[model samples]
Target: MKTVAAIALYSFREAVRNKILYSILFFAILLILLSVVLGSASVHQDSRFLLDIGLFSINLFGDIIAIFLGITSVFQEIERKTLYNVLSKPIDRATYFLGKFGGIAMTLAVQLLLMAAALSATLLLRGGSVDLQLLGAFWLTYVESVMIASFALFCGSFSTPYVSGFITLGVWLIGRLVQELAAFLDKVEEPASRHLLQGIVALAPDLNFFTITTQLTYGYPVGLAYFGAVTLYGLGYIVVAMGAAIFIFRRRDFI
Candidate 1:
């Protein structure tokens, strides 16, 4: 546990130092601020429009940051020939992998918090109030980013960071449109095609479940029960991805 904790802290510091993280975060905040300007153009739906755009900006950038950190966490070490030194320590491979993902999760949390704060401040400046509905959306967005990070770690186990990041980003894009895939399933005329698509969709996580932005924009809050369900789903997916990452990393040759 202590080993994991130490590695996690080290990884967090390293992740924070990545200049790309700051660049993306700066743009995310700028978009959040832009939402306010754009919202003013709406006749009576400025709040709704602003909330939607603001949350969308935060979630989209958060996921990208997750992918970047998660995919590179392992590969960067190898690139610098530092993995050899780290592995020479008493750290177990599985423990080290968890620590990397934990660190990425921590970094993402900080990123999201900053964006959320910015969004809230922007709202306040626009004569709007932060509400529990917004918080719920933020919570789900955090969980979604963490889950994607775990998946990215799993992908990084056997591939270069660039390949892993592409794979992770592709999967994330598809998963975000899980609902559309489901809708398209019925349009397939062939039974085999339908079944294959259905199976693929089943394997992909429904990212829509992690989103409550529409409801928030409509002034409705999701119940605690809904939050529990999605949180459980996210945690379950994280466990599966992390376990796979550990399994793959143990057999990975760092040379």
Candidate 2:
């Protein structure tokens, strides 16, 4: 456990030095400021528009950072031959994998907090208040990003960084649209095709379940039950993804 913690801290510092993370974060803040500007132009529904755009910007940029960092976490080490040195030490393969995952997750959590703070400041400046529902929305967004990070880690364990990034991005896009895909599957007349779609739906992460932007924008009430259900779902998927990553990493020959 101590070794895992050390590696995790190292990973966190390594990720902090990545220029791409800052680039995405800059754009995220820029977009949030732009939302404030655009929101001011509207006579009515300004707050709604600002909150919607701000939340979307946070989610989008956070996912980008998560995916990029997760894919490169292992690949960068291998490319630099540092992975061999680390593996030669007392650390077990599972510990190394978990450390990397923890580092990336920690980095995402920090980034999410920053973005959420910016969003809150923007809302306050616009005469809006941060309520429990708004905080819940941000919490769910962070959870969603964490899930993406885990998926990226799973892909990185077995594939090159480029291929891993592509696969992770594809999964993310599909995960977000899984509901629409399921709807289309329901219209399929062929048994085999329907079955395949059903399989995809069952296997894919239901990202829509994490989405609360619409309700937040419209000031609708979000139930605690909904949050609990999605939180459990996200945690379950994250565990599976991380376990798969550890399993694959243990089998790989670093030599």
Reference-based TM-score of each model: 0.97, 0.97
| Candidate 2: C-alpha lDDT | 0.91
lDDT of 2 by residue, 1-255 (tens): 988889999999999898889999999999999988898888887888889999999999999998998899999999899999899998789999989988998899889999999999989988888999988988888899999999999999999988999999999998999989988986899999899889988899988888899998877899999998999999999999999999998999877
Q: What tens digits encode model 1's per-residue C-alpha lDDT throughout 186-236?
A: 789999999988897999999999989888888776899999899999999
Residue pairs in collision within model 1 = none
Per-model lDDT: 0.91, 0.91
Worst 10-residue stretch by lDDT in candidate 1? 213-222
Model 1 Cα shift for residue 219 (angstroms): 0.9
Q: Which parts of model 1 have CA positions greater than 4 angstroms off?
A: none
User: Model 1 TM-score?
Assistant: 0.97
